[model samples]
Target: MSSNKTNALSRRAFLRNSSLAGGGMIIGFNLLNSCKPKVVAEPTIDLASLDYNDFNAFIKIAENGAVTIFSPNPEIGQGVKTSMPMIIAEELDVAWKDVYVEQGILDTENYTRQVAGGSQSIRHGWDALRETGAKAKHMLVSAAAARWGVDPSECSVSEGVITNAAGETLGYGDVVNEAALLEVPEKVELKKPRDYKIMGKNAGNVDIDKITTGKPLFGLDYKTDGMVYAAVVRPPSFGHKLVSFDDSEARNMPGVIDVVTIGEKVRSLLAEDPSFSSKISSSDKVVVIAKTTWQAFKAKDAIKATWEEETPMESTEQHNKILTDLLDGSKFNTMRSDGNIKKAFAEADQVLERTYESPFLPHNCMEPMNFYANVTSEKVHLVGPIQTPAWKAGLVAKMLGREEKDILLEMTRMGGGFGRRLYGDFVIEAAEISQTINKPVKVVYTREDDMEDGIYRMAIKYRIKAGIKDGKVTAYHLKEAAVNDNMYGLIPNFFPAGAIENYQVDVASYKSNITTGAWRAPYTNFLAFAEQSFFDELAEMMEVDKIQLRLDLLDKVKPEDDERIQYSPDRMKEVIKMAVEKSGWGTKPSNVYQGFVNYYCHNTHVAEVADVEIENGSPVVKKITCVVDCGIVVNPLGAMNQIEGGVIDGVGHSMFGELAFEDGKPTANNFDRYRLIRMKEAPVVETYLMENEYSPTGLGEPTLPPAGGAVANALKAATGNRLYVQPFTKTPELLKVPEKEIIG
Candidate 1:
């Protein structure tokens, strides 16, 4: 908030002298500002409306004539920190090397849809940015034409220069003063696919240099004058509410600024009484705001608060029982239904059924969730690792009861946001704290807070059944039982909402104390582990080649002809076939085994074949060959990077990563005990892209589902075992059931 920024230095000095004397000097570091366009006026162009002295939207214009575009989408290693800028430079006709890019402070008009989750950053910004760049180019060419008193058609723009047919040239910077006055063209021609100079060529990420050089661009690196640090004390168990708290001890501690109780209350008019907000109780413990992160962390452990305990809910075992019972009773939301499954089962020679379960997962990004907020009575200023700044700005305005224009959300590079940043809860929390304390505050969530307070990927239980006759597929039925509260509610709309014919997906959310939200691939990450594994079982019983069977099914059941499915079964087949040919389907190496799966989500299609070997009953993925088609790739290199990263992240979660909750408390709170896949565990991944002309879709999530399912299916082939449960471990075998085939 602006008021907080105005008051930060004074409040910090007051606290430092009166409260935190013996404490170490509160560091005040100044960070370099991001580059935004500078709007200037000339005789020919009108720059008054375009140039907002306060909103400088462009970056640098070097003496060599290079331009850098700044975007609000935080690059969190998914390559977006650079990929989005590539689109602008490509259209702007600038040398890739000349363009230096930076993540813009979160400002929606200058950088709309600053959120980076769902892999929608590039897809959403592609067309509009292309037009923006093309229009700018056109304006520059027109300015040159006017100077030469020639038709604009005789002038061409290339390499940051506007030149005439006679080869007379002028740098864009020279004409920008005049171009700023010219009317922007309504419709600038877009480059044809073949004529593209920057989109497809595997250009490396523009931000690679910054990241490799250890640049101070991450949220953790953000700082300001007299900025303080704060850590909220969340509930030990998620659901417990703060009934009362004694912060007297915390107040007396050195470096303790103030311990504030934070809780949400719906409008009194909307809710009967603001008794207890329906939202998850963010810990009611005192917030220890101090001059330093270390001091705040140290004082955090010493703070104490009283919680109103609620009835303990079901354990993992009990939750599993409830889901298993739902599947047994054939009770679910019924996502899809087609032919008479009962008659098909009765007519079949053999009916096979299997149940699968996936544990709750945490998105352990390399960095972590963090935000910096400077709030005051008049305005709010925020910067940090946020995916959707526009969305958060709206929420911040509402939460602060301030005009939306008063809030400035600055986007920074994120450590990671695998559907986690979708919830602006933490961002709003930081903004509110800064507003309450009236200071520039950086809120850092300890690894424990990040993991424990994480909106967990829901634990799901699935039951799959198929009718097989003479080893051929006849009929199929799927029953998926999981939480309906959060991400699962969005699955029906995003992924398999309409793709399957005769598919029955039933969803149920069990009331529990643990807070559940979104993870990487949402339900598909877990559901694919179940659905694709079941398909493998169906393949085994039918004595058919796995890849061929899936292809044949796609040919038979085109999604376009079926109203039950949302995706093109034809496109799904394309990727599956592509992966099969590339991975050498049906070929088994002496030392390695292969498994395959194809799934669609986030408007993208991915099919992967994983080669795995059993090492002491644990399936180790040695190599993964994936085929992805998310339509026209704006940047092939960047898209490939996302696919590769998502695959590795998916592999880690499926095979090893899990969050164990004991009485709603996380078991493995840190990376050491949590067991994430490190560099050593990373498999040799070969990724291929299917070319298509359709509008580009997302690449992040689609690549994830296949990694989990493919690895599981490969494990099935290597040992003739099916591990239905997730985090495939050695001790307990989840996929012990017999294999069955699909009946068409």
Candidate 2:
């Protein structure tokens, strides 16, 4: 399939020239640009003829009054498919029941900020989407006013109907034909928060019915005519390359098509281009293409492949030792510093120090990594789950020596992303296989292949130190060390970096062959665990409630004149107080011990409190209370679901999730080896949203950052023994308490 060919027309030009098919209006708005938010052009429409060829246009109103909003971002179960459309429908004055959502293909010329990572889907698209809807509404109102010879101001829209002061009304469909001919307004006024009829309301996801009915909506469910399947035999470890392969037996096997080996030439090209290489796994692998997925997998298993392992690989134990050594002796680079930390620590009344470690985590997305691609000398066609389609398109264009416009990239509903799909290695692999084989091919990564291929959450270690005097933290120091990349990339402005007076943040890095990429909240995933856990210890040291201690610190932050600090002290306190009140902070049942933590990230404020108890010698999470202030919350139902899912994910990872390695190969290849929190272990999650009129922020990641910390603090409160290591089950002393008490 080739990309839709059209004139080099701007969005305004397209809108002005567009014609409705069945008597309705189609509005196209200029999407956000790469450099800054700028209005590109004015929209226009024509009623003389019916033409529906432009793919850049987003909103469509049918003659039957059915509204279809094309969602511009990938939906990785974060509800962008619904929440984004809700924004447009609210501004367009349409009922939620009438809106249908469709995933728009990646078109950088028509859409800005198309990526779904960093929890930026709703945050980035909020204004642009609203404008698209508001413009459409304006045109419809203008058309009705002209037809009735009434002032446009006298006609108010409600649920796709225009009502005049005389109580006479016209359905949008009735005037849509004329509306299509009207010139697009230079500017349209958007509705205030109070006037919202669809946004912020608890509207169900548009795709929920299809998802519940087991319809094929995800990329794994996507199929096309004459598409073949392929599986790969990747290097057993990082920095290893395929040296030789015997595919005679595999070639003779049933349904085996071909065994294609990705050689050093392509690998070298990827290595030379860091921009393309960074977004994909650079591991060299041999692929087996066949008629079916099962056949491909079986043939891959049957092939005898040998790899040349050049670089030495380190085990998890060795890596941990390296981290410990770095923490002990490395000369760290200062990421941030304020006041004199040495002087404050020297004069402090008390000093508290602790070290925390978190192991590598795999995304373990339910669908694994899969993609479909058909590449020819002329163009490349790709359809799959991708968070950054435009970026992937650029990479593929560069690799194939073609322009990005020649590549047709589309996004399907993803079963789960959690930041894993942000990297488009699997998509690129599919394209490469299809290009080599000269056929449409779908590349599928089995659960084991997905787990061991290593685009994992980096293992991290943190050292925290604080000086307390007169019931106040006088000085603070945080030193972080991680494998491959620095934590600064994920969290450059970590909390308490500017919240404390005599604060200094030191960072160090150790290089490794293991591939690491963003996992959910990235550094905040572990930073929150370590930082909040340290805060809990600090609260105990000061003999104060955890919630109050955080509030006090937030209050202490003096407003900086610089724009670098993105957090507001007032906003932080709001969520903390809300969480405390909603969770009954100090008033839980006698058997329950509650742990509270508040954090700000991804432009969202979240405070979480986990209530736990020691039952049968293990920490039992009874319940969790979450308070989130993610701006206006475009869709309440979707927001709640995201928070709940994030909390459960955090809890699962903290309690029993880890990806260990031996000789640079992942030990946990599948669910059996990598433990995930089961349904029985999940806690009762109660979520509350703070009321606000501010623009929407992110909801996907902020809630998860504090989950691990809250649970860790709760475990400490329950057992009176602090667990500094992640996968709390790894701490033997904490687990031995139950058995020891039983034996005694």
Candidate 3:
């Protein structure tokens, strides 16, 4: 929950007082802030006399029968711009062709859950948006009923037209002015899933044309008349602070305006705010302002700065040693325990143990980190790519000592977020530089700056032991170690947590200077690989098929006893079976080995199957099949795209993603060292969505967890070797293969 102060203007007050404009009606809805109490009763205010607030998103009907819908969440290429508005248009009973979509400004008073992380845009906004459209339809129907002197129940709406039994019809635009004057309704009936007209249908992204035509839609493309480009020369390593700088050479560079050194007060503020700690200039830095971005970059490179260095940082090998020691020791905090684990393990016939490890990964977004800000004594104006504008606004308000209303924050299309933009460090960096220079500044980050000075996905180590007897699993234990925290922070109800009879989970932490945060599916991104790969090993030891072992464990949970399990075993099994059947798991073409993996996360179930072949000693993925049960997919095409992207992203990270550190600085500063999956490496992805009536869940992340596990398991089957470490290319055995046999 947010600690920010609440707004005085309530949703009921805004809707009640909103008036008609240009003979058109505007309808607004209230999204209850999770931290605040839900508004139950409607407010008592006049509907004919007040001005509409442009900050709140709403549906507007004009005299020409055009319906304009405002989408409140940031457009981060997740298709929320089109999908969210589709929800409103479906319930509004409007034609898709008649609708025009626009992005709404950040306003916490009217919009709740504006952030795009956790894949929550569709999950949380479905009910609120549906009711908003239904309310507008109700008002329009009443207006048509009064005009025809007929009962409101006798009016039927279809495609924005209200019709009566006498065959008389009136367009929503014709009666919108009259509807604007009517009393607001407290409740309106919503359409059922079977009757949906626009939702569940394939609609192209609203900004596709602009994106394809190279129109300026991203924050990097933003430009203003007086805007100046700025770049920073930050500390080369973590655990250090800038002491002094000599910028004489930079000052003489071409197009150089001025080199400003940041003060300690702002540095302290940045350090105190966790949202800004990952920024390159968070501690201390010198900023170069110039006429163009290229000039700023060149000038920034010419600056020489002295820093107060702290203790040298440990290398990745040292960190791995720390994790190994923790696993070897008995000191750990037990998170979950069920049945008698000691008795079960002691009584078992065979006990098996294996350890899996993953490296810290960078976001590596295509656009790099950038933001635009204009700070003045009067007010602060900001525009850039941010996942949580409302939260950023609150932070800015506290930093600037200004009212939240005085600060303006706008969102622009992001090139790629993937949980990276959730932190607004870059946004605040731009604001601080603009405030110091007293000019509108666009702060730009080079690829090296963006990669080295950014928060990464925490490197994790997992050790799992299982006890088996009579070819059936008897007990299970899991221990995790990582920097700052453990894997359980994001995934407490990890797979087999409730499936096994005797289970215990423990965690140990090793603090490091490296900063970490959510990346894609967070913990599950790596946990899935460890857990699923271990399950494959277990099946081999037990002489049982992997899929059947999972099904047998799932069958242990009673259908009537709901309190024991965190996830539905039935739903988990459904996806597993779907993936197996669709991919022909038991039958494959010659020279191709198939691997299967299934897991649940983000309130969604996903199962993936990967087909791999050992082509000249290197594993090459030919195709992948993904089955997802997110419940009531709003847009099939967009959902498929999300799944396909997640699969490729997960596989790419598992195969060639690793960020190493030595002496408190990142080793892989740019793409030359940090390898990503190229176009030739991507596999043919086939996706399937389960048909169900449950409310829609998020699809952005659920498909990612299974990708790594499936690919690793497939590689094992193809090459007769297991990959316990991530970035499979790092395996010593694979490196030993002749260079001629290794595919580039």
Candidate 4:
């Protein structure tokens, strides 16, 4: 028998609500509100079974007058589970406090853009969610109007009660059944931003109760009947392969059920293939099956495995040399180009150059990586916290040699995603183990294992040069040399691309055995640091105001002139001024060294200012002030949380996060070896949201990109030294002159 304890509290909650709800196809839902005080149902839905194809998946109105809203996107601490539904609720014209929010299962047929990445959940779903809620309200009003023998134009809804022009009122619950039977409206008017009630207001996170009460909300807490536990032992180091393994001792250990050897197969399928290499460290992995997690973990330690380095092993020292060589001598791919940069540089009176470097960073999600899978001959069931559920489902089906139709996925609230959960390596691992054993299995990764076997953010070096003519900057060029892969294609269309008349972006890469992938804001995370720092240096060298230089550059670009220009100079400039005025950039105290930068990414524009204070010979980040213009705010509190979290996370990583490889093995396997920003080092983040009428953009990632640059620039202002590498903690010799400016 499996030793995993049942999550009775959560299980009971999930079952109770599942029995009360109806609907599957999500064509529409009867969104009803009653004047007779709202009845909020228990907010739990397993989403494992349903029959009503006529209703929408997002909203359910129980006959007993209970309202429940389903949030389909993965809840990865980005607060989408709470905020997304708020958009629907606002259009549904329902009381926010009386509505229950639940996580919806993967329903690719009904939901579009299901993945939670690039901070795009809201931006992509904003229209659909609004229309969904508005249509629901439209049905309710139509039903009320039919009863009153009046048109819908004569009826308006307010707080769940439908009222006629003559003040004749009817509760939405009175005609909900009639509303469901009505024809779907061709169009429904969405609420204006000025009319929003629940949107701009502060609403608590939907999972805060379960999270704060220690309920089984995360994937680690997931459990089911007759499920076995699994732990994997991957190759000792990257580029190594499994020659052979002895499981005699492992099978004999306590609670050990079986030891499955599939490492050789994994190596054949993924490790040796160049087309799909470095997604995970190219290597082998041994799956240890046991009755319990502890037993599986303990038994796995007893297995002895012989490994061989089949490929060239990578080290940090060698990687640094390779990146430097690529930057110097490699013929780079021109990602973007404008006016001739070569001629502009050749004729310039003065030129300035700088390089910034960042090490591969591990995504340290609080829950680590885990997934549960129950695989049978006919069907495969996957349940866990995954960002890309549909994509993972297809990959798992392909790997298991099963049809996509046989796969089913369910999502649980995640502890943190940070782009790590976007890959389904652990999901496939669970599926593979369960397929071999013909039973349900849950695979869990220890923190050490998660770190060692990681798809890290690529270690990259950026070299930027700007040619200056008499009193004006004439040209600019940027080159990126990364490990495994280069920056994404969209980066070429970013801010400076349009701002500089003679500009170019070139990229080159040297493949490494170490794996790499997206981390939070992707390339913009560190690119902002490099680019913004370079711009700051430009301002200093040109004897111009820092914020003014950006304003001047932004003035040079017009959104209409360039087909590739994604950022608006008008919007970008507004934010720059906002940051300067809001942060009091020009009026800070002498003790506080401030740095400001404006950035656009993930479809959101953000400006940030970092305040660094020298205390006891070391620079202490006092605070970060951010002014964000992502259009209208969905939830003020949630938006602020994202900004604060992003700034803290970005600055923290820039200050200390690093994963270095030594002969194909990472030096830091856990928090003990790796340094992160602690509370003492964290700066107070104050955000000012722009009130606008434009449609909303992304929020989760934009705030993070500008933060590193703001902090790095602030440090330079304080210490009069430029630290070009990540992990700013490596140097402690920054000037100790706290009484006055070191260089300013």
Best by TM-score: 2
RMSD of 3: 4.8
lDDT of 3 by residue, 1-744 (tens): 001111123334533532323356666676432112332322112333334453244786776777878788988888898898888889899988778886776777777778888888888887878887887888889989999999999989899999998999999988887887776666678899999989888888888777787877888988877999999887888777888888999999999999996645456666667545543345677899999999999999998889887646667888889989988899888888889889999999999999999888899999888999998888888888898899888777776667988777778889998878887777767887888889999999999988878878888899999999777788999889887667533364557877788989889888767777788887688989999999999999988989999999888876466464556789989999989899998788756788889988887988999998767676688899999999998889899899999999999999889999887788999998898999999999999999999888888888888899999888887767788999888885843333533443
Provide the lDDT at 170 for model 1. Answer: 91
Report the C-alpha displacement of residue 556, candidate 3, in angstroms. 1.8
Residue pairs that clash (backbone atoms under 3 angstroms), model 3: none
Model 3: residues with Cα > 4 Å off, grouped in runs: 1-21, 32-55, 270-282, 487-490, 558-564, 732-744
Whole-model lDDT values for every prediction: 0.67, 0.80, 0.81, 0.80
Top model by lDDT, which number?
Answer: 3
Q: Output the better candidate (3/4) by lDDT.
A: 3
Looking at candidate 2, what is the lDDT of residue 183? 67
TM-score of 4: 0.92
Residue 171's C-alpha lDDT in candidate 1?
88
For 77-132, candidate 4 gives per-residue lDDT tens digits of 98888888898889989888877777777766556667889998888777778877
Weakest 10 consecutive residues of candidate 4 by summed lDDT: 1-10
Each model's TM-score? 0.86, 0.93, 0.93, 0.92
lDDT value, residue 652 of candidate 3: 92
Where model 2 places Cα greater than 4 Å from the true spot, the runs are: 1-22, 33-57, 275-284, 488-492, 560-562, 736-744
Better of 1 and 3 by TM-score: 3
TM-score of 2: 0.93
Q: Which ten residues in a row have the lowest lDDT in candidate 2?
A: 1-10
